[model samples]
Target chain A: MQRSPDDLTLSGDEQIAGEADRPFARSLPWLLLVGGLVGFAAAFTLTVEKIALLRDPDYVPTCSINPILSCGSVMRTPQAEVFGFPNPLIGVAAFAALAAIGAAMLAGARPRPWFWAGLQAGVTFGVVFVHWLIWQSLYVIGALCPYCMVVWVVTILLFWYVTLVNLGRTRAGRLLAEYHAVALTAWFLLIIGLITVRFWDYWSSLI
Target chain B: MAFKSPQNTTASGARAKIDAARAQDRRRAARKRNMTIVASLVAAFAVIVAVFLAVDPGSGPDGDTLAAGESRYVRSDSHRLTTAADGKVTLVEFLDFECEACRGMYPLVESLRKEYEGRVTFVVRYFPLPGHFNAERAARAVEAAAQQDKFEIMYQRMYQTQTEWGEKRTPADEYFRGLAQGLGMDMAAWQKAYEDPATLARVKKDVADGQALGVQGTPTFYLNGTLVQVQMQDDLKKAIDAALAG
Candidate 1:
């Protein structure tokens, strides 16, 4: 029943193919956990800043400068508190859930199928809000809130990581394995470059 | 006849093994279905997020109508006209004549005035910031234009040609006269009002009113008494609706 060395070589080739096919099978959990944790921290920080602003009118944080770099200028505007409530309340709730998911993942708990679906949904929401806030800051408000920019940058990175992790989990990994890492890194760099260009004026004006 | 036996046996064996191919097809179909479902879910979630962010949510009353005990205008000086028109919403704009942002906001105010004619009352108040050299003189010129019933025309002209008169190189009076001539105003009357000390006092009063209301910059607005911090059309409409409702 002993196979020849040529037969053994063929079997080894098949094993390697199988391993290559499931490339991200081991790393999916870790990716989601870390991405979610970073996302949650960024969102939580923004929520705290927004709450402090809401609690006190005269309490202008150090961010509010002249017409262009003012946090109060944009926050006092209608765009900041869409839905008649400060939009940061949504951030607080959603990011808290993300952080809990991250904790569960770190504790070696396998998320149910529904959890993956919901994470995808939440990340999509976060990405859309980030883009909208950027538009408001660039075009409408004509000002940039420095803390808000931090939230935006972190949201983009987390969204990209979550998307890659989700693709790696499902059967789609077979298709996405070709350039996942390269594409994700490229996207991250592009986003950072864009945000830098958008705030170029503020950067130049700094003393 | 001897060759037929082996060929027929092989053909029958292949027919018997066709079940495995059918099973493989079933597995492929299941995987396809799962992929489709996941793709649809992701797409649906994206659409929902886009819609939520796109919705404007309307404006709510979050701040005071005006900071406590603040006067609408600094003083009832010669230049200040207090007109009362019942049941119409009023829009009061405090603008610096030489400010770039104020210049940008000029046409929007004009368009709103025209669009909501008779339903809205529009008032212009001058708040020339001290930093800009020509802003005070330009405010005086605009006040003179008001005396000639050419306030709107000259206001538009100021923004339209802001760089020429406001920035440098030309005196304020000369620039105002050129703008007046361009707008077909009577030159003599325009000059008389431009030189009047009373007009300067009025411009100063406008600045005081703006400062009293915590107006830190040019192009500040008051819609029926609430200080409007943002200039979005939809938000402005919502604030107007609330004012009407009250």
Candidate 2:
């Protein structure tokens, strides 16, 4: 069913109008395409590694560098399977959906407001879940998994921009859209600082 | 008082209608703009990540960082495996006496020390974790043993009897004293050293050095200047062999 363009949520600013429309509209699909690929690769590899460990208990994950930086330690923890299945499995499905949605949008599919809303909800869960995983990794698990860190980085970026775009029609989103990079940089620095502090022993030692 | 013709009134009405028609295009235009901004945001983030990786000091595969220097590695000088520090290779271990992993790798390390006795200068540094009840005390006891030139004897003693007092909450000071007595160590001197603040200071310094070198857990080893990222015994051996070869 075709609706008027105004009916679609996440379609951004009215003031710029025809002057800036077509070029910007064409770039969303590419945005999703890049984020989805990196995120998918990280999840896919983690799942494969987990499966390998399960198949052979003696198998050491390639990412297990030491006691402080070990993927194998993270994978064995119960939190890695919070939903009674490996968390990376969820990442696989979500990233695929993200890529598909991006491709469709690129192909001129104008998803209803509900689709954007659902994506917002999903990524909200993702951002929260990943932060919790970061906490568990640093405070509880006492190790950093390389692939999982990649997922964490992408998930934060995905959630931030997703929320920004989804609120495209709102005054708040528009204002935020102006300083999008600043907010993202703040979020990145916070996480990076936390990681640096938590593994200070390891990080400082590197230098 | 100015006369308004029907033509003027009709023109005004048409202008309002045109404005109303333009309103319908606003949402489409808004979505287009938002998408573009979102896309640019993602692209910017990707660029940031790219820049970070480019400048990342530890840029090897699997996030393997470059090794720290050897200038500040040692503090206590008594716990070397070889008498002379003239060996081509210097292997440093940050160990906790009460750790199971340390206990597990003890025999392997002992054999490796024997195997590379002359070629490698093995240095042991105390890095007792807070969780282990007797680890710090054990380190002090070893330092005390070093006073009598019996550091290796105490080292072998603690690991050998790790099962008896390793994870126990009760202090193993009495058990350690018995071993020291059996080895003919002067009980008074060893006791005084155990209580010496200097003994604890030595452990703390080693712990700090280990942290500075990014060592988080016990039994962290460095082959020459590089941290040995060992998953198995062979990994340590391979690193050591490479250093020895070089």
Best by TM-score: 2
lDDT (10s digit) by residue, model 2, range B1-246: 222334676776785466447653654665566667656766775576556545664432112343443344553352786632465788888999999999988898898888888888888988999899889888989889998999998999999988998988777888888888988999999986775544655566677667878889989988777888879878877887899788
TM-score of each: 0.40, 0.50
lDDT of 2 by residue, A108-192 (tens): 7776667778988998999999999999988876678999999998888888777877666466875676556656766776787
> lDDT for every model?
0.63, 0.75
Once model 2 is optimally superposed onto the true structure by TM-score, how far is the C-alpha of residue B186 displaced, in angstroms? 31
Q: Give the Å error, residue A71, model 2.
A: 1.2
Question: Model 1 captures what fraction of native contacts?
Answer: 0.00
lDDT of 2 at A183: 69
| Best candidate, lDDT | 2
Report the poorest 10 consecutive residues by lDDT, candidate 1 chain A: A1-10
DockQ of each model vs. true complex: 0.02, 0.05
The parts of candidate 1 lying over 4 Å away from their true place are A1-42, A65-68, A169-182, A185-202, A205-207, B1-246
